[model samples]
Target chain A: MSDRSLSELGEQGLLPLLQAFCPAEQRGDDAAILTPPAGQQLVVSSDVLVEGIHFSEATTPPAAIGWRAAAANLSDLAAMGATPAGITLALALPSDRRLSWLQQIYQGLDRCLKQYDCPLIGGDLSRSPTATLAVTALGWVNPNRVIRRSTAQVGDWIMATGTHGLSRLGLGHLLGEWTLAEPLRDQAIAAHQAPKPRLDVVPLLARSQPAGTVWRVAGMDSSDGLADAVLQICRASQVGAVIEALPLPATTSFDRDRLIQAALYGGEDFELVLCLSPDWAQALLELLGEQAQVIGQITEKPVVQLRLSDRTEILSLDRGFQHFTTH
Target chain B: MSDRSLSELGEQGLLPLLQAFCPAEQRGDDAAILTPPAGQQLVVSSDVLVEGIHFSEATTPPAAIGWRAAAANLSDLAAMGATPAGITLALALPSDRRLSWLQQIYQGLDRCLKQYDCPLIGGDLSRSPTATLAVTALGWVNPNRVIRRSTAQVGDWIMATGTHGLSRLGLGHLLGEWTLAEPLRDQAIAAHQAPKPRLDVVPLLARSQPAGTVWRVAGMDSSDGLADAVLQICRASQVGAVIEALPLPATTSFDRDRLIQAALYGGEDFELVLCLSPDWAQALLELLGEQAQVIGQITEKPVVQLRLSDRTEILSLDRGFQHFTTH
Candidate 1:
């Protein structure tokens, strides 16, 4: 027969399997004890993923659901230039969910945490009407090197890591909205199913700054589309942005206009949008090579503008993906 | 007309309302930056509350739901003998939920956090089929004074803070399983709807030991039944327990047997069950006075026995509450 349902297994019966993913010493405690890195500030963030809203069981595998949840929180930490410390996951599962599905979710979460050199520290589990995953990630960063979204200055160059629109295209394909041929189709699906956080660029940014000088860079993860992220940074910093170009994935199969729309408003890209001094941006570009690209510049005018070859138009602030509202 | 729904307000529009409870400087960041206390280990725990399973709108008010969620996580920190640092709340609400209802929840959360001297740090908001709240609490504890459930020794006395079964009786009253009278009914309902974590006992336990001496106490919160908490400590410590008495509230409205059953098996008490050396137990008893009582002792027999005046019985291991299973 198949594995027992969660109701049959019970929460107590499920502890051993969950404990396998966490360190034994940290397991079996009311709260896990963590020692923060010496001389570093702790950075904490949380994100929630709901079935049908954030994802669908029809399109997202159980493991991918777990992976996406962890990645989302980790992306926030990466935006703050923090090194991961640990993760606390509170999961609400339907009583009828299979034990194998939960095990797969934990495996995916463990895979991501292992890659980031962090442990599944502590969490809670309960029965719910729908599957929900809330992940709280703890990380550490040097106080001097920590990044913020409110410090962008006029004349700073706007840059982004990785291409956009792939995840959106992947979701379209998953929903049967369109079809794509090999390689690109697989790439798009993988991008949607398992988005990677821009943690690798954090170290590169740290090294790009001089030893004694303070680092001042404004950054945010483009989880809610590239244009939305840039607009947010611009609003927070009391500055404006002129997007001269859109970062598109290297694919000729999709139309340019459609790809541009996806790039501007696709969401869930998990890439970093950064604003920094021109010299520092150049140094980071040199260090990151082709992994990063400059697409815009911070302006004195307090408005976001998309300046294409034919015309320039102001972007609406409300165009970003939002919960409870249809795209 | 009624206030706007979450779907109408959207996630961006909801930020300012959620930001009201957190510090302005810490708000609007991808992740909040926190400095750990000087020379202390961080204790982290998370808890989730789901509608219809953990609570019902028919019985629990919106503010109470928020209060209970924060209290549940705070109780876990208290079990580790830690001082509150901060709380991060991830909430998934039905899109149709009113803005006023969410405001009340935040108000209750703010009240709890203010009482504990912690701030609402960071979190995420999402849309779900049912209301779900996940709270992650961070606390700090002195390394030498940290408490663990696996440290119970065979000759230690088992004690608990506050009377048991009040919350259970309150829940019963709320569910209409039994009707309670006037003051008792109100008390029970309050206890059920807004349980308080025994954070005050943490300082008392810390001071119970002499200067420069390490703490050797095993502890856990009786969020699960008192008997279950005792059993967990025993199982982790590889010891047995003998319950010579049961802690009952000061009331004559209920029969002794029913009260005993409730005290032994009723969950959601939010009280502390602790095992310590006899001298330390006596010291804590003196410090706590009427707020605490001794009910049992650690044994080497590897079984839990309830020794009553008329008869003795061995308690079943599976009698405690387990999620995803019917009580």
Candidate 2:
């Protein structure tokens, strides 16, 4: 028993070890008691990352896995224009030596938590044949400031925050299929490993919600892919979209078509695709500078049309990350 | 694509089908907005149930699986005496036809949620090699009304709500090693499949805490078995306890030793182990009647003594449902 594994700790012995990692205020009792601030709606969302399905042990380090898992859930909060308050994690791991792996993962979580001011409320640790991470992040926002995927109005500009296609290129680098020079490789790898959630953009979008602002924001994270996300926004909002061939956001050695393909179909980008009025779009771009890029426009028809530099075409929009379905 | 599997529905296609089951107030947005009522502290907890590890297709049905999964988290809320508000589930499954399986699970969740007024708020669906269900339940409690597992005091009466050992006996029947007749078998199976959380007891305990009352309640659910749960409370509260060989509840044909073992070590009872002043124990007993039973007394020493009719022994307290550790 003295030399027992985490399995031996059996949640009992494991609690003390893990409790040190959680914020002090969130420890004890079966559940944490949160004093949600007045006038703010508590926004909650959960995301799970299963090993082999979401990441490869061969390529992704433990810390990156932890960082990415937390980031994925945080991205959900960002999509809603919510400021993260806390997160509860449910971790399933394989072995005791994985304790070190978990510690690294906690380091990753701590970095994200500290940067975003979200505390690690509490979590459950269990053993599994394969590793899985589930994160439920709680955030706060004015009820009127909530952004939804189902409210993109006709004639609204479709905009994306930050760049797209970097994570795809990063995946390529991880797979040893593409070679990039110097900082580009590091940047690409970072994008894939620890993509930043657009928490900073929430306040800017929130600013547009006071009294009688003309801007209406409808959005979600572009995790599956750009085209698929556009299709989802259109389907949810009961509108269509016309996506122009936007310039590729990452420095890549791939040809134009490959870069375009990555931008349209490469998943794990973690960028926000938003719909807003054109005037607000201009105002947002001026505020966010180059971080906000207008990529398309919402239309009344329920179709997704991709306009290339030299050709106009409608895409089937069938390729995005769907669980159980193999690409 | 029309004939595509859940993997093809990817999270996007599957959302609408599952969305219909969740409350309309909790749908649409990336994150659900919850307005925590004034003067109440938000209480939240999460639990995970993995297939094969926690249940098997040979023994448990999908609805039971769903029911048990939600029940497990709700039990945590019940342990804290919190009234459930909403729940967010993250489900990982294997196939497309399992949509029916999922619907059954949702039916189970709906049954529990409806009974407690806890709405199905939001969730994430993903594909997995094996099925996994993670539920995060949110509730609310008066800040002063919160109970803890670590506050048991010396000379306090150790009590239990509801019966013991039925779930374990039911598990035995489920494994085909045992059999029960008629209503008892059904009751035992229900105990295993959908053991009720003691939400009804919270108000009773809260009723005791109105200024200068001698009663102080310290409690937690006995999901891990009586001995293990006792040991846990004893350790956290830094007190010992003397558990009597109490009369077993539920009609069973098992011999005395077997019945005694089941009562002492059977896990998943979902009953609560509480500590309170002796006088309040009588008050609570009068209030709850047979639902509340005095099983032991907290002692000053740091040891657990189990007293039989003619013999007394120290308990090793090794048995419990521990994750990762094999039975």
Candidate 3:
């Protein structure tokens, strides 16, 4: 376990190898016995954002990389109505990369943590030939206000914070097919890069604490295409959804076809999905004000259909970035 | 965001890309809500055992790969006096490998989990050019008995559970130096392949739950070499130690010079370093008996020194396998 070079030793060698060198206190324990401040439950989640699978070679920036890592995890806590706490980044990259890029990456992470008010507690850094990053964000949840996707019921009006598809536009720009002006381009790019996690809105949602029984948050982040996200919600809640196409927050840069596609498929929106009943919608709106808009309704039909203004036309898309799917 | 492919998306895209796809419930909530029933305060630890790094190319078997992944993480839980619960694996592998090999890898993992009585909960699987496996094992720590390294006091007796250096012996066998019988060779190999995480012993120690004052099993695990581990403990507790080398388990497979190196530096002993008052040693033995042995006493000098039974031996060794020295 301890003798040979890594290439000669392989995975099995780690136990004995580590046993020889690692401190007994840190070594024997399952997890480090963190001396957290009095009364803090460990917050945790694991995310693997793959390269060539999730992003492209052309456009992602180092800071954006850093910001989004925290944002995705932070968003999860938000949906659960939990406060952002500590984070761990388990990153895998090629061994040959320069240290500057890594420092810049951390810089981006620092920016996000400061913005979200989350602390960078721990992380694991490793090298791989291909770039891959897995981060597990830990946060503490208030015992009462924990939001879950399973709590949403059939009658709740579905709502979302922020616009969809701007990230896709940024991606388009990266792909060279689209030309965008400065502010709009920056906005679109920011939607993809340095996307904000709604830590601010979670506590507010908790105060109103809209019907935890039926009218609740479900599914999660819009990183997948909107249609795919709706499908996930349906799968998790075991109900169908009828999303009104016109009500979706639209962007000016897209044509009708592209706009609808982005609404349906363009993702990385980092929006909140709130499902509430008719009477509670007003209460929720008052609590939330203009943070979001009513976009759809939950259904039992087990189908995700896009409803048109005509009421007769429905749109359906077959493909979006399913993690299991091969391109 | 969309359509740019993975490479163009780059490193800093973790947040947006992850936010884009992961379902809200699973993505970034404060902590993953494992809703069965929170009986024990959850103990969590993650180890990213990398390839061409932690292990060797020659000795790494699929079964060993699988086995060590579970064993390494479970050992930490055991160190905490925690019962192994659910385990999650995030695996990144090189493509173009056999499906059978992958299946065998799981077979090894399944063996450890089943034997240790922990269930496989959830996981993330993907491909990487370099083989990397990260395992997070969750266990339950007794609220009152959660042992920590910093809690070790000034006069604590340092002891180790089980013998050390067997893993190095097995590595020697694999390298064709250990001319042993098949059973002994297998034993060494198994030591490397599947570390016996002392779960049963941990709970027993917790139940015994010695004095309110003595060091409560501080500075656990044998990741780095024993001396390095001792150094870490001293640094954490802000003290020093004189290790009795005779009681420190030595092996026969290595030659005189090699034996000393292996015994002192060979990692992965998976032994517990208990910090107990000398008064409690007898009671601990009444409970743990001969499986435990007093090896040293904590000192105030803030320096770690080794004592040899023969001739107050002078040593010529400090450089050890530090996992990565290349960078």
Number of the top candidate by DockQ? 1
Give the fraction of reference interface contacts each candidate recovers.
0.88, 0.69, 0.21
C-alpha lDDT of candidate 2 relative to the true structure: 0.80
Local distance difference test, candidate 3:
0.63
Chain B TM-score for the candidates in order: 0.97, 0.94, 0.81
lDDT of 3 by residue, B1-327 (tens): 233433333322223333332334444332465432244566667777777666765667888888888887887777677777667666665544444565666778888889998866545555555667777777776566776665566787787776666677677777677555555567767777677776767766645655565336675665555555566577668887777753344444445665556555776767677776776655666777767777777888877777766534322224445432341
* Per-residue lDDT value at A133 in model 3: 71
lDDT digits (tens) for residues A262-309 of candidate 1: 888998999999998888999999998888899999999999999989
Computed on alpha carbons, the lDDT of every model, listed in order, comes to: 0.89, 0.80, 0.63
- What's the DockQ for every one of the candidates? 0.86, 0.64, 0.21
> Ten-residue segment with the worst summed lDDT in candidate 1 chain A?
A206-215
lDDT of 1 by residue, B124-157 (tens): 8999988999999999998988889999989999
Instruction: Give the Cα-based TM-score of candidate 3 against the true structure.
Output: 0.81
DockQ of model 3 vs. true complex: 0.21
Error of 2 at B90 (Å): 1.0
Native-referenced TM-scores of chain A, all candidate models: 0.97, 0.93, 0.81
TM-score for candidate 1: 0.98
Q: Tens digit of lDDT per residue, candidate 2, span A1-327?
A: 244566655666677778887877677677887888888888899887888888886668888887888888888898888888889988877756445667788888878778888888877877666677888999988776778889899989998987888888888889888776777788778989999998988888755443567446889987878887788788879999999856366554556677777778886788889899887877777888888789989999899999877768776556665675666
Tell me the lDDT of model 2 at B279. 78
**Per-residue alpha-carbon lDDT of model 3 for A1-327, expressed as tens digits?**
223443333323323433432234344333644333334444456666667755545777766787777787787667666676556566666555554555566778788888877655444555565667776665676555566666567987777767777778787887787887777688877788878877777766645544544335554655555676666666667888888843244446556677667666776777766666756666667777777778788988878777776443333434665343244
Error of 1 at B288 (Å): 0.6
* Candidate 2 per-residue lDDT over residues B1-327, each given as its tens digit: 244557545665677888987878777767798898888888889877788877888678888888887888888898888888889999877765446677788888888878778888988877767678888999988887777888899998888888888888788899997787778788788998888988888888866554577435788988877787778789879999999845376564666676667767887888888888887777788889889789999999999999978668787655666675666
Where model 1 places Cα greater than 4 Å from the true spot, the runs are B211-213
Q: lDDT of candidate 1 vs native?
A: 0.89
